[model samples]
Target: MKRLASVVALAVVVLFGTMAARALRIATPAATTGTAIAIPAIDTAAAALHLAAAVRFPTVSLASGGPIDTAAFLGLHQYLQAAFPRVHAALTREVVAGLSLVYTWKGSDSTLAPVVLMGHVDVVPIPEPNLRDWEHAPFSGDTAGGYVWGRGAIDDKSTVIAVLEAVEGLLRAGHTPKRTIYLTFGHDEEVGGRYGARVSSTSSWREGSSRHSSSTKGGSWGHA
Candidate 1:
């Protein structure tokens, strides 16, 4: 009788396990083939120059919530407008919280959800004591050995410039996207996104705009 009871328990466990495996198989999604996209040709030297120039702006954000650098932020904005004329002419730009920038490139299809690309302009302040350890000045925006070096270059300024560059190139190529795109550049992200990203997000929410995809800066990059 004991042997029979053990066999019954084992049979019940196997039955449930088989059912769970079949359910898992049904829940798994099938892999689909993706279409390959043609890569566009870009002027690498011009892009590098733009990035180097961007690094020169000393848009520093302190953790203590200090007074904002109005000149630095404004200068950077002016530079961008000058650098990418096509983008300025094609997209609607708004200055949020007096510093953060929100640019909208309207699409043809209103039914499709919009896309948001985020990056910050402000960089953390370098400590006075750590000044001696630098190979290059933090705000020098130096381009040496085929690399753009400076604060904010990798953290976020790169993304900002890269997006603008792509947009400008696309505009030059007469390519209009089907889905709308938003380029959000926050000014006070190093401290916190309170006055920058939050305000922009709130405005979008109020306008009943839902994003289909969002991408941010400050991630790993491949190097040669």
Candidate 2:
């Protein structure tokens, strides 16, 4: 009788374990459906050229906290003004912290919060030892081999140029948004965003308004 009782207990345990495993295996996943947004088209060749021009500037942020390339940064700013004439003319451009660039495109409605688009123009310095490893000069802004080769090509300049191109195109088309748009190009993001992005955020917050949303150049957007 004791042997029979032991056999029954083992059978019950097996049955419950199998039932639990089967239940877990058949469980449904959470829903992930969402709406899709349609982004407007931009000028590919012109945007590429602008990005290439941006890359030529060696706005390198030294890790050891050395002097920044102020001349190159000013040159890049001049280039941006030349490339996006409509944006510079239409938007309210301001140089925050003497290095960062901020452009505000005033919208039709003042009640709505402004949207901020951010990107870094600063890039890591290329060491002399790794210079030979590069197929082309790191600061050449070479658009050869069907790719933009430079230090800030992908790290940030591409994004800043893309945003400028989009805004410039919109300005050309005379499209005005309901909410204001803010373009922030930080100059010292490689070391830390302290002097550039931090100052902008603090200043804006002091004005009793914050960003509604933020879109970074690396294709990330989030609500504030």
Candidate 3:
């Protein structure tokens, strides 16, 4: 019986070892094709500063019955308008649910379906007890040692600011998409997106316009 158990264990190990080796053998793609467009140099200093400034807002989203910071959300809206003047000038802005924002950039061709870019600005709050665990103040928007520190720095604000920056830059360059573009910024995501994403979707449906696809805050692309 002892010899049989030893043989079974050895056989299991060899099978798993073979399986691991096979899994590790990933083949390179046969053919990859893409245009090599030169990426323009970004002003690192300005980019970092802007991200840091966005981090300063403590737009905490809480579950129903929990506290929500409306002031921070409003402040972020004001900051976005000031930062991306061209976006505000070109895109038609509307507030949904009193706090959520939607911006539509009209396209040259009405036949093409619009594209929606969705991002949330609200973040989960850092509990008072966990404050000591943070390297910097939760709302300080600290930029140090090649890092931006704050609550919404990575959760949702980064995507929100990035989309605005891209749109503003494109507008400045006089670049217009063939299809209409919609920018939707949700105010609540950390808890539940009921008042944010869900409302935006319902609003779009009511408008009788279909969106081809949506680029979500956390890098998800979905067909609508």
Candidate 4:
């Protein structure tokens, strides 16, 4: 029985190792010495700074005729365009309703269906005034006590920045994906997705997804 258990454990390890080896290895951005630079000058502190500035936009996307502040949301879009010039210049961007920001990076092969990486830009509304029970004000986007505080920071901005970081870093590194990559950031979520990115509303976000052979793959918020 002891010998049998040892054999089983060894077999399991070998099988798992083989399977993992077959998995595709994602290439990281090339930087300085040709080493994988995950992000171009990945400024952890600066990323937080950018998030803080974005939080200040107050992009609250509510339901239709539901007090959705289009102005604030648009402002955020402008800021991103201004901040990431390389991203804007390099990738082909499609904007729907001045809210949804969808960027498409043409892959080495257009034969493959596109993946829709989605998230929302508009955050939920904050109370008009403090309840006096909270320790930090929402939308502060502050790195307080080493914790990132904000409305969209955790919910989605993290993903947004991540995608941008990966792509931006990759671009700076001069790497490209074989399959198409589409980035979709919706405008509304808290209230409803009536205007949120459903992967069907925008043509670019879907990337001809309506086709029978073409399918869409995307990652959502809240994943490490």
Candidate 4: list runs displaced more than 4 Å: 1-41, 129-131, 208-224
lDDT of 2 by residue, 62-86 (tens): 6545777799999999999999999
lDDT for each candidate structure: 0.82, 0.81, 0.79, 0.68
Tens digits of per-residue lDDT for model 4 on 23-76?
646554564342343445676776777777777777876657866577788788
* Clash pairs for candidate 1: none
Clashes of 1: 0
Error of 3 at 146 (Å): 1.6
Tell me the lDDT of model 3 at 25: 100
| Model 1 CA deviation exceeding 4 Å by range | 1-39, 201-209, 215-224
Scored by lDDT, the top model is: 1
Pairs of residues clashing in candidate 4: none
lDDT of residue 214 for candidate 3: 55
**Per-model TM-score on C-alpha atoms:** 0.78, 0.78, 0.78, 0.71
Query: How should the candidates be ordered by lDDT, best one leading?
Result: 1, 2, 3, 4
Residue pairs of candidate 3 with colliding backbone atoms = none
Candidate 3 achieves a global lDDT of 0.79
lDDT: the better of candidates 1 and 4: 1
For residues 69-166, could you state the per-residue lDDT of candidate 3 as single tens digits? 78888998898888889899998898888688889888788786777888888888778899999889988999998988888887777788778877
**Clash totals for all models, in order?**
0, 0, 0, 0
